[model samples]
Target chain A: MKAAVIVFPGSNCDRDLAVALEKSSGKAPIMLWHRETEVPQDLDLIAVPGGFSYGDYLRSGAMAAHSPVMREVKRMAEKGVRVLGVCNGFQILTEAGLLPGALMRNRDLKFICRDVHLKVENTDTAFTGPYTKGQVVRFPVAHHDGNFFADDELLKRIEGNGQVAFRYAAADGTVSDATNINGSRNNIAGIVNEKGTVLGMMPHPERLIEPKLGGADGKPMFDALVEALS
Target chain B: MKAKVHVTLKNGVLDPQGKAIQHALGSLGFSGVDDVRQGKYIELDLAETDAAKAREAVERMCKELLANTVIENYAISIEG
Candidate 1:
């Protein structure tokens, strides 16, 4: 599958994501700059990697979301291309209106960086299809504004529609309030858009894909991309 | 003409930065302070001389970009 990683000026995780995509898909992805308004033709997947894009100005992902590249990203999504956004990338997706809800300041007002357990809540979408539902995996989360917020009614709608892809869970894989890594509503760690073509999550799955990196639990997410597209 | 926009987190939305400021005040023996909610003040220099037009433009900027309506509210004032 052909893939590209969008690189904002301050995006530090772009290469990490590119490496993971290359390893999983057997094809190196193009590193697209944020200023470009056009995407490579017939792209199967696009990833907006994590980092303090635009230095997290005016809200975590707000400024970078307005970069010219995002307008193309949204247009590509409408055409059924799979899009993955992690951490600050997640914030960008929400701000760009590709994903619902906004990521607010973390409840404790601290930039949290740690390994956390996430329960795979949905196994039908391309992003999470390779992971077993209810399985617990470790992913590192590093961010300050990971708190996800939405009105009660909208929260219910996404939940009822099975849009939630991952929830913070204990080591045993049981989800609970105490297990919430960030102050995400309903302990949500990841969510997919209603179309199932886009996903936004706070955790960095790319960081866990190599065994030497810690664990290869994140490999399946990358693997799922190749499997679904090809 | 100049326009100033105030952007603040909506009521009931958690403001950790604001809470931190509150804590700092208490540590300084300012016990009379009950709460502290911080927001942004943005000043803009407008090319348009008409106050009404400037206000409308700034309001659009607030809704479209300046403030995230989902979690924050923005108020705009124009001065000539």
Candidate 2:
């Protein structure tokens, strides 16, 4: 798959995401700077990596969402290109109106950095096709403003449309408040847009694509994109 | 022209930081504090001179950047 990783100032995970994409697709993805207004038309995926973009000045990802490159990213997504945003990337997507809901301050007001379990809620979408529905996977979440918030009406709509892709869960795949690591509404860890072309999640999947990094649970997500897009 | 903007979390949204502050105040022996809601106060110096036009411009700024309308509400006041 022809993919590109968008790099903004303070984006620490840009290289890590590029490496993961390269390993899965067998080709190094193009690195696009945040100032660029255009992206290669042949690209199939655009990955927005994690970290405090724009120094998290006003709000996490708020400034980066308005970066020039995002206009092209939005245009590309409209033409059916897949977009995957992880961690701070997720915050940017939501701020950019590419996804629903807002990521707020953690309920406990602490920066949580640890491996947590997630339950795959959908397997039919390109982002999660390689994993079975209800499968449990472990991924590391590192963030302070990862609490997801949505009003009742919007939450019900996304839930009814199956936009939810993954939820915080236990080892046996049970989802509950106790398993919710960030106080995300409905334990949401990831969600897709209405067309399922855009995905934004708070976990750092690229951080654990290989066993040497601790686990390979995140590999299937990349592999799924390669298999489906190719 | 000077524009003062106050961005506050919308009602019905949980304010964890405000709650933390409230708790801290309670522990410090302060009483009768029903609630504590945290918000951002931003002061901007604008080149626009007319108060009406300044208010209008600052409103746009608040809508576009100063406040996220999804979870926050903003109020703008202009002073010369």
Candidate 3:
């Protein structure tokens, strides 16, 4: 799979995401800067990595979302190119209108950095095809504005369409209040679009692809994308 | 002419910074603080004179830089 990782001014995780994609797909992905108005032709996947893009000024992901490259990203997503946005990338996707809902500040008014347990709510999407429904996975979340909010009707629409891909869960794969990091409504941790081609998640899966770092659960997500596209 | 654009999170959206300010005020013995919502005010000095053009410019600035419309809304007012 020919993938491209979008890089903005403050994108700190571009290398991490690139390494993860290279290892999983056995092909080094292209690194595209935010100022470029075009994506690589015939690209199968585009990954937007996490970071304090544009110094998080005005709002997190606000400035980066308006970057010239996002116009191409939006165009590709509409054409069914697979897109995965992690952490600040998620915030960017929402700001760009490629996804619904907004990521707000944590309810506790503090930055949360910890390993959070998540439930695989739907494994049928292009991003989660390697996981099983109800499976538990651990991914690290480090952010200040990770609280996800949407209107009641939109939430129901997303849930009813089985677009919710992951939810916070207890160690035994049970939904619980203790695992609800950032107090996101209904413990939402990740979601995919109705077409299953675009995904946005809060956790840093790119940081956990190796066992030496901590866990290898994130490998399957990248692997699944490669397999489905290649 | 100058225009000021005020961007604020919509009502019912969680305002952590505002909450922190409210708590700080309470700790400092300030009472009657019913609520607090943090926002941004951006002043733009434009060369355009037409009110509609100025308003349009400010609106574009808000959408393109001053605010994230997904979570926040903005209002623009022109000043002499």
Candidate 4:
């Protein structure tokens, strides 16, 4: 499976996502710079990783969303290329209109950095097929702006379409407002486009892929994509 | 030419920052302050001197890059 990790100036997770992708697909992903105008046409997946891209100026992901590279990213997404956006990448995707909703600052207004359990809400997607429905997996989530918000109409539409891929939940997999880690609307932690090709989320699944890293729950997510694309 | 732009979260969207500011004011004994909503104010110095064209340019910038229209509403004012 061919994959790439898009790197913005302040993106610190590009190499980490590349590590996980290489370990899963057995091929090192090209680190595509943010200023470049095109993605390699043969790529099956493009990952926008986490970081304070553009120093979070104006807003997180706002500036990076308009970078020259994003125009190509949007074009490729239209062609059905799978895209995974994590944390700040998720913000960019929303700011770019590739995904729905907005990620606002955490309700408490403090940066939260910790491991949280996420329940796989949709097992039918390419990113979640390896997990059973409602299965709870712990992933590291670190961000100040992770609260997801959407208009009522759009929220109902996406929820009805089963576009929600994951939701923050308790350790036992119970989804409740109290269990929401970042105050995301409907406890949403991740979602896919209507076509199910683009996935964006605030949690860092790549951080949990190795046994020595304290969990292997994240490996299957990458494996599922590689298997589907290969 | 100068342009001032205001970007604010749409109504019905939760403003946690604003809420915090409201609470902080309450703690300071400032009552009757119904609420506080925080927004962004940006000033741009433009080369376009025509008032109408400068306003148009800023409006385009607001739509394209300055504001996230899905969640934000932007207003522009050109100054002499």
Candidate 5:
């Protein structure tokens, strides 16, 4: 499967994402810089990785969202190419209007870096098909502005469309408020677009792909994408 | 003409920097302060003479780069 990882200034996770994609798809994905106005022709997947793009200037992902590469990313997403955004990438997607809601500062006003438990709320999307609905997994999240915010109407629309892919869960696998790392409405950690072609999440699945890295729960996320395209 | 564009977070959006400023003010013997909402002021020196055109240009600048319309609001004031 042909894939590409869009790289922006201050994006530190590009290589990690590229490695994960290569291992899963059995082919090295192309690395596209943010200044490029177009993506490679016929790309099966596009990934926007995590980091403090533009030094998190103005707001997280705000400046990076306007980078030249984003226009092409938007066009590609609209054409039904599978797009995945993780952490700051997720913030960029929201800022770019590919997803709804704003990622506000963590409610606690502190940077949180740790493994978080999440439940697979929906497994039917191209990104989450490898997991079963209601299964629990653990992934690491390190972010300063990961709190997701959306109006009630938008939240309802997202929920009604089954866009929620993962929800924060307690260590015992129970969906509870106490386990929510950030004060995201409805305990949401990840979501997909209505068409299920685009996925964005605050957790760093790329960091958890290897057992030596702490857990292998993230392997399935990449596996699902590769399987969907292959 | 020059214009100063002020950009601020919307009412419902959380402002951590503003909150910190408010707390610091409270500790510094500034009482009865209802709230402190911090914002950015960007001064621009433009050669445009028409006020209407200047405002339009500033508005475009705010929308395109100076501000994020989803969470922040911006206003432009021009002076000779």
Candidate 6:
């Protein structure tokens, strides 16, 4: 599967996402910088890794959303290229208008950094194909602005369209306010666009790709992408 | 021309930072604070001389970058 990882000025997880892609697909993805205005049209997937892009100035993912490369990313997304955004990457997608809703400050007003449990809400999408519907997976989440917010009408529409891909849940896969680590609406941890090709999530799957790295739960996501694209 | 823009979260959207500040105020023995909402204030100096033109440009800037319309409302005031 041909893929590329977009790198922004302060993107710390770019290499991690690249490594996960390479490990799963057995081929390295080209690292595209944010300044470049063009990307190869043949690419099957573009992963926006997590980090404090543009130093989280103005707002998280706000400045980097207007960067030159994001214009190309938006173009690619409109053409049906699969896009995965995690953590600050998710914030960027929302700011770029590639995804819906906004990520606000955490409810507790502190940066949370730890492992989180997320229930797979939709396994039909490219990113969640390997996981069973309602399956709970563990991924690390480290961010301050991961609280997802949407207006009542928009939230109902997004949920009605089955665009929700993941929700914070307990180890037993039960979703509740106690498990809503960041106060995301309906415990939302990730969501996809209506076409189901673009995904924006707050957790870091690339951070736990192998069993040696705490767990292999994240490996299936990369595996599913490689399998679907190939 | 100088343009001042205020970007505030829409009502019903939770403002945790504002809440934190409110809590701090309460801890300091200040009372009677009904609610608190925090926002961003941006000041811009523009080369445009006309008031209407400057307001128009800053409005575009706010729509494009200074404010995210989905969650925030922005107001522009231009002064010469």
Error of 6 at A154 (Å): 0.5
True contacts kept of each: 0.78, 0.61, 0.78, 0.83, 0.33, 0.67
- Positional deviation of residue A151's Cα in model 4 after best superposition, in angstroms: 0.8
Give the DockQ-based CAPRI class for model 5: acceptable
Calculate DockQ per candidate and list them. Answer: 0.82, 0.80, 0.71, 0.83, 0.49, 0.83
Of 3 and 5, which scores higher on lDDT?
3
Put down candidate 3 lDDT per residue, A31-59, tens digits, no spaces. 99999986677999999999999998878
Q: lDDT per model, in order?
A: 0.91, 0.93, 0.90, 0.92, 0.89, 0.95
Instruction: Please name the candidate that would achieve the greatest TM-score relative to the true structure.
Output: 6
Model 5 lDDT per residue over A1-230, tens place: 78999999999999999989987888999999999986787999999999999999978998998999999999999999999999999999998889888888887788999999999987888899988888889999999998888778789999999999989898667876787778888889988889999999999899989898888999988988888898
Instruction: Put the candidates in DockQ order, highest first.
Output: 6, 4, 1, 2, 3, 5
TM-score of each: 0.98, 0.98, 0.96, 0.97, 0.93, 0.99
Give lDDT: candidate 3, residue A153: 80
lDDT of candidate model 5 versus the reference: 0.89
4 versus 6: better lDDT goes to:
6
> How badly does each model clash, as a count of residue pairs?
0, 0, 0, 0, 0, 0
What is the fnat of model 1 with respect to the true interface contacts?
0.78
Local accuracy of candidate 5 as per-residue lDDT tens digits, B1-80: 99999999888877776888888899999998888888888999999999889999999989877887767899899997
Q: Give the runs in model 1 whose Cα sits over 4 Å from its true position.
A: none
Per lDDT, the best of the predicted structures is 6
Write the residue-wise lDDT of candidate 3 on B8-31 in tens digits. Answer: 998877788898999999999999
Residue-wise C-alpha lDDT for candidate 6, range A1-230, written one tens digit per residue = 99999999999999999999999999999999999997898999999989999999998999999999999999999999999999999999999999999999999988999999999998889999999999999999999999999999999999999999999999999999999998899999999999999999999999999989999889999999999999
Candidate ordering by TM-score (highest first): 6, 2, 1, 4, 3, 5
Give the TM-score, chain B only, in order for the candidates. 0.97, 0.97, 0.93, 0.97, 0.94, 0.97
